[model samples]
Target: MALLDTLHRWAGGFVGLVLALLGLTGAILVHRDAWIMLPHAGDAQIQSTHVLAATTERLMSNPETRPQSVTFANANLGLDRLDFGKGAGAYTEQAGTIVSQWQTQWARPELWLFDLHHHLLSGDTGETIIGIAGVAGLFFVITGTILWWRTRKTFAFRPLPKRLSRPAIVRHHRDLGIVAAPLLVLSLLTGATLVFRPISAVFLGPGAPATIDTALQAPKGPKVALADHLDWRRMIVTARARFPDAELRSLSLPRKESGLVTIRMKRPQEWLPNGRTTLWFAADDGRLIGARDAASLSNVVAAYNILYPLHAAKVGGLGYRLVMTLSGLTLGLLGTLSVWSFWFKRPRPVKVRRGVRP
Candidate 1:
């Protein structure tokens, strides 16, 4: 028991700051759609297939201004985003009018904040560190709950420490941790599982990872570069005809040696902000190579798809956003104070006089 308590304290001290930053950033990111203010940004989402196809065709036909990827607008935010890689991007309206553009991610707070929360601004290395922190955070929550069992009777509810002293902070930390344990578990588990896929086996059972990977992997196509003026309209029309109820979510060009143009769509029933329903088209002629319906995914894979929406508060509307906001704020408080109590509030050794008695 004592060893568990010590481990929890030390682990929290080590990763508390990182967790705090993630929590604060995550809280801010949950309301991203509401905060990105622009002309027609709040306009109603266009549902017409003709309009969508026309707009996509117009934007992609221009090679000089074409982007590597396009994330179309949804019901919440009505401006499509174009990614030109290496931090350059722009936002456009449904009618294919560019509303804003930036040469670097730093030009937009949303882009950088997202990068920070997901990658800590250090790319893949930062993402690995975040995954490690999430694992440590999960340990803290579980062990902290067990340690709290001893003093459960003395539990008192306080959102913040009554004073900045060590005893007060320790008491507040213990009680607050218990209060937020469930939410912390949810957030930390989902985040860690996302970065470290093997962890999913615990919840999803063995073979789940392989099943998900095989199910979502894109099909191989002929080795041919994307056409200079590919039939974007034809591709959109084909995808719409197949998934009549799905909304077009994103379009991504082939990467590296792959010659497949991928189109992602969101069905009304899907929880993922960008649904897993996908279509792969031959880049050379824009012919449909294959399509995958999100609904037909294996039960295990379908269950795994819900993790992102749960973690990001994407499905439950404003109420869930507020719930996750509270979770983030609670985690922030717990992490910040845990670090403070562990390092700054430690007891100081007493000084002895030059001529000590005895």
Candidate 2:
């Protein structure tokens, strides 16, 4: 009991602030479409690859730039994104006209928030720290629930106390922790699994991970025409014929001569918007070289795939999004209050009787 109590405080105190920040940022990110404002605004339609091919050729033909990837717009955001090398990109309309020049990820608020949430703007080290915090979050959820059981009889739930007294703060922490325990655990588990990708292989299988470039290879033959010159229309047509019912999610243009143009699609019954069903084409002639269907995925891999949509709330629509938002807010508040109660807030002073006591 003593060890658990000590660990509970330690986890919430040492890493509480970081966890809270993540939670708040995560809540904001869930509604990323609403917050981000793309400079180019147009009703460009992309029912076929003909329009995309024309647009892609125009961008690739530019001597000053090279196409790296082209992400098609979904229902939420109606702006096609074309990324060249680092710090270079552009947004285009369906008609293939440039709406705005690409800005650095930092310049885009959504991307900025994204970097902060995922890496704390500190790269690999930050990601590791965030992963650790996820583990700590799980610890808090488990230990808090266990400790709550002892005080279950006196439990009184409240959003917050009217006073800043120690008892009131503790009450709020205990009650809120209990209320948000289940959701918090689920979120932390999924997030941790993502951070430590190897965990998927441990529980699922080696093929369960969504790692890209499994089939990538060095260019063997003589160089062909630039990737932009390839028949993108045919590539799209082939992809559609291959997975007739799948919806095109995004496309990754070849970055190098040997690189493949990878297409990710969301098929029916898949939870993720960018379903794991994937196809790779040769950059030269748009020849089909690699392919993987979500339906044919191994049971372990398929089970592992569920974590992404579950953690990100990609499929449950608005209702699930709202639930995730609430989860984040509760996590943020719980962490913030726990820290305050431990370090900043002082214990209530004991009352003294009149001089008769002395």
Candidate 3:
């Protein structure tokens, strides 16, 4: 118990507070896409890539706007983000550029929610601080697990005591911590992985015939325009034929001046938001290039790769979302309880009336 108290005291602080906030925000971020205001989902038959290409070309011609990116959804729906001027951008889903923009801020409700998680919208400082907090939280959770081990048999869900006393603080501290410990461990460990990629990369190496080291080394194909050799339409046709039930997922326009265009698959029966199989194509002449299969990855690496999508509840749909949301609230409760326990332990000034005896 003495040892547990020491560890707990060291673990709870401002860094813990930041981590608590980051975790709370992170949980909400998991289902953000479903909640954030965006244009409606698209139809079954999305338009051809070439058609979007024409619109992109026209949008580019206007000097008033410079295309930052053009994303394909489907025939009736798509998203275009443009650099109108400065750091500003507009989102256009329907054909012909409509000026719909969101200000980049920390307090814009949903965007603020995002800011609270990533940057506190404080830019790099907040990001770095949050990253450090995640590390602290990892330490806290691990230490907590060790502490809980001592009280394992006696553990049961119990609320804090009504009175302010040493025993009351102890009960509140122990019981609440025990109840939320499992989720704390999960949320913190995953949160830590998101902040520290190297940690994740290392964890991804344990259970495989070959390490994630091999997976990360996937060939950096010589620079070539992926669009040139592949036809986006034909690639789509082949992909649809291959995974007929799959919906049109996000597309990655060719990155290499000489690389291929990439498209992902989202299946109807599956909860995977983005297909793991990326179909690569020649960007210039539109030819089927290659399909990179994630399933082929060693079990070790595949487990590591699931961190983000799982944490964000982006993988398993509503069920996962509910778990994530509840986990987040639990973390928030843990933070408040820890802080409250600390405050309750501190000595308070005794009440004294002017004529009262000492």
Candidate 2 residue-wise lDDT, 131-181, digit = tens? 989988988888889999999998888887657876788888988889989
What local lDDT score does residue 335 receive in model 3, on the 0 to 100 scale? 66
Decoy 2 TM-score against native:
0.85
Query: What lDDT does the true structure give each of the candidates?
Result: 0.93, 0.75, 0.59
Worst 10 residues of 2 by lDDT: 212-221
Top-down TM-score ranking: 1, 2, 3
TM-score for each model: 0.97, 0.85, 0.69
What C-alpha lDDT does candidate 3 achieve relative to the native structure? 0.59
User: What is candidate 3's lDDT per residue for 1-358, written digit by digit as tens?
Assistant: 6876576665674455666676678777766544535554332344454554454455544434434344445322345444333334455653435446754543235456876787776778887777677677666666766776877786666554556565565565566666676766677666667665666655554334245556634344436643222333455577666665666564555553636556676554333446565666565655566765665656666676666666667655578678878778766656665666666566578988898797
The whole-model C-alpha lDDT of candidate 1 against the native structure comes to: 0.93
TM value for model 3 = 0.69
